[model samples]
Target chain A: MDIAQTSPAADYPATARTTPTRHLERAHYDRATVHAILDADFVCHMGFVADGLPVVLPTLYARVGERLYIHGSTGSRPLRSATDGLDVCLTVTLLDELVLARSAVHHSVNYRSVVVHGRATRVTDEAELTLALDALVDHAVPGRAADCRPADAKERAKTAVLRLDLAEVSAKVRAQGVGDEPEDMDLAHWAGLIPLDRVIGTPVPDPAVPEGTALPGYLRHLG
Target chain B: MDIAQTSPAADYPATARTTPTRHLERAHYDRATVHAILDADFVCHMGFVADGLPVVLPTLYARVGERLYIHGSTGSRPLRSATDGLDVCLTVTLLDELVLARSAVHHSVNYRSVVVHGRATRVTDEAELTLALDALVDHAVPGRAADCRPADAKERAKTAVLRLDLAEVSAKVRAQGVGDEPEDMDLAHWAGLIPLDRVIGTPVPDPAVPEGTALPGYLRHLG
Candidate 1:
C-alpha cells in the first residue's frame, strides 16, 4: 500500500457537488486515491432516494477496476430500484485514529474515504454476474473464490447485483494528528492520537469440518 | 448494554422507507435496540441531498439519551445545511462477523445497524452546547471531558453542533451464523464465522507532554 501523498492537483474531473466547500485542500480527485480507499474497505453505505426521501443502507461491495459491484436480494427495495436505473451514492470510510486536541472544537478523526455518485444498473447477464460475484468474494479474501462452490442457477436467479461506474468520485481525507491553533497549543491537556484499527483475529473453524482439518493458506496469510 | 432480543413488535413507529422490504422480520423498532448500536459505534455516515445530488459524509457523532449530537465546522456544507433544519439521515453500523458458507451466494457479513431519518436543528444555547460538547468528548473516551479544557467562546462561535431526535429510527440486525440451505449444508467445503472488531492500541503519548506521564486509567480500561 505505497500511496503517494501528492496534492490534489490531478486531472480527474470532479462533479459539481463532489467539490468540497470547506477544507478544499483535503479533497482529492485522483484515480489512485479513489481506488486505494475502495479496495481497502469491504462494506459501503449505499444512498438512494426512495419515494422522494433519501435512504441509506450498509451492504457488502467489491471494486473491480473502475466498476463497483453490490449484490442483494431481488426483493430488496434498493436493489429493485437500482435495477430501474435510479441514481445512487456509495461511500466507503476507514477510520484511522482519534485526534485528541487541546480545544474541544478542534477534535476530529483521521480517516480515508471515497464517495461515488452515479446510476446503479442491475446485472442481468449471467456471464458478467459470475465474474462480478467472483470479484466480490476474492476481494474479501483473496483467492477464496476458487476455493468455494459457484452459485447455482436457482441461487443466481434470486440475487441482484448492481454495478456503478466510478466516473464522478471524490476522496476527502484527514490524516494529520491535531490542527489546533497556536494559542491553544500550550494548553495543559493531553493531546495526541489514539490509533484505531480493524484487525483480523485467529480464525475459528466451523464445527462441521472434518476433525483436524487445517485452515486454508490464503486465510492464514490475510492478516 | 443489556439489550432484549425481542422482535419488532414494539410500538416505536418506523418511517415509510425504514421499513425493511426483504427481511421484514429483522427490523426492530425498540428504543433499546437503536440505542445500543448507537452507543457501540463512534462514527456514522450522514446522508443528505445537496444541490439535488445525494451526499454522504463520514463524521463523528454521539448519542445522548434520545438525542444525537453531531459537531462540525460552521463552514462545512453538511453542518450548515443541518442547522438550517434540513432533512438528514444518519446511520451507524457495527460489523459482527464474516459468514463463510459453502456456496458463494450464501456468503454474508453479520452486522447490527441503526438508521435515523429526521430534521436537525442548531444548538445555540451556551449551556446546552457545553453539555453536548461534553457528551461528544466522553463518548469517545469516557470521563475525559472533565480532564480537558472546555471550548472557549471564540471556538464555539466557529463550530456548529446539530441535534437530531431519534423518533423515526429502526435497527436492522443479523447475528446468527451461516444460513445455508439444508441441501447445501452437507457440501464438501469449509464453513464458519470470522468475527471482526475495532480494537484500541497502546496510546502514544504526545511529545509535548512531560516525560514519564502515565497513560490515563480510562483509556487503559477501554478494550
Candidate 2:
C-alpha cells in the first residue's frame, strides 16, 4: 500500500526509487529527517519527463505535512500536463560546508538534501488551494502570508499548485569533517571543512511606498 | 548544427525543451550569461530518465567552455548508463534575494538559474578525465585543486565523469526589486527584497595536523 494513505509512520518505507545507489551510509529514511531537510529550503529542482526526455526546472515549493506543494502559473506547460498526474522527482539541497580532503577524490560537501519521487496532481479544491498558497508564502517567510494581501479570486484562478505526497522520500546528508585516508593524513596538505551558509540581509523597501510603512513582525528580523 | 560542433556561438540554440513556456521575458539564451551562471555554482541538480521515470539527483559539476562535467562514482547506476549516452538535464540555481510583494501571488525569488539539456557521455579519455576532475575541484574551491594530492591511478579508475556539451541551454534570471502592482503599492504592507547570500567561513583544520604545518597562501584569506 502507498504510505500516503496510511497514518504517518516513524520512517518512510524506502522503496527502490528512494534507495541510494552510492554512499549507503549517508541515506536517511526517517520522516523527521526528510521533513527537516525539505523545510530548510524554499526552492526545489523539479524534474519531469517531457516528450520522453528529462527536464529540470527550479521552482518555489513548500512542504505541508506529508505533501509537497509546487507553485507554478496555470499557463505553464508542466502545470497543464500535471493535471493528468505527471511523474516528477523534486530535489532540494542545502550546502552546509565544503570539505577539503587530502586528495581530490575524497573532497566533498557537507550538505543535507532530500529527494522525493512521486506523481503530482493539480490542486483544485478551493479551500485546499488557499491553504497551499498560504503555506507556500509562510514556508519561505514565516507569517508572510498573513502580512500580505490574500490573493483575489481572479489571482487564485490564474495560479496552479501541484501536490505530491511525501510517500517516496529520502534524505541524504554528510555533515562531518574531512574524510582523508589514513595514509594521506601525514601528507603536507590542509584538510578540513570550510563552513558555508546562506544568510538573510537587510530589507530594501520599495521607494514608491508610503513614507512610514512599518515592516511586519515577520520581516523585523531582517530590518 | 549543434553549437558545440561550430565555433563558440554567442547564444545556445534554444530547442523546444530549452524555451520557457511562461515568463519568456526572463529567459536568457546568451552564452556569456549561461556560462557565468553555471560557473558561479559548483553543485547542480542533474535530472535523467531512469527506467522511463524522472530522477533528480544533486551532484557537483564544472563548466569547461561549452561543455559541463558532472562527477560521480564509477559504480553509480547513472554514471554507468551515461557511458552509453543518457539523456540528461542539469540545472544550477543561485538564489540572490526573496522578493516580498504586497500580494501573495506576486511573491518570488530573485535567482539566476541555467538549465542544460543534452545526451551525456562518460569521459573515458585520460587527458579529459584528468581535466574534468581538476576542473571539478577547482570550480568549487579555486586554487585549492593544485594544493591537494592528485588522484592516483586506482582512484582515477574508480571515478566517473560525464560530459554534456552546452548546445541546448538557457538561463532564467529575476534580479529586480519587488514587482508590486501600481494599485497595490499603497497597500499598508512591506514590499521589497530581502537580500540573501551564501558566505564562506574560516577553515577548520583536521585534528591530526602537525604542529608547524603552515596554512597555504591560497587559504590565508580565510585565516
Model-by-model DockQ, in order = 0.65, 0.85
* Residue B223 alpha-carbon offset, candidate 2, angstroms: 1.8
Candidate 2 chain A least-lDDT 10 residues: A1-10
State the TM-score of candidate 2 restricted to chain B: 0.94
Which tens-of-lDDT digit does each residue in B6-114 have in candidate 2? Answer: 4555667788877788888889999779888998989999999999999999999988778898988888989988778989999999999999999998999999999
Best by TM-score: 2
Clashes of each: 0, 0
Candidate 1 CAPRI-style tier: medium
Model 2: residues with Cα > 4 Å off, grouped in runs: A1-9, B1-9
lDDT of 2 by residue, A1-223 (tens): 1224445557888899788788899999988788888989999999999999999999999988898998788989889888789999999999999999999989999999999999999988888898899999999998999989999999998899999998888999998888888888888888888999899999888887677878889888778
TM-score of only chain B in every candidate structure:
0.92, 0.94
For all predictions in the order shown, the interface RMSD in Å is 1.4, 1.0
Clashing pairs in 1: none
Candidate 2 TM-score restricted to chain A = 0.95
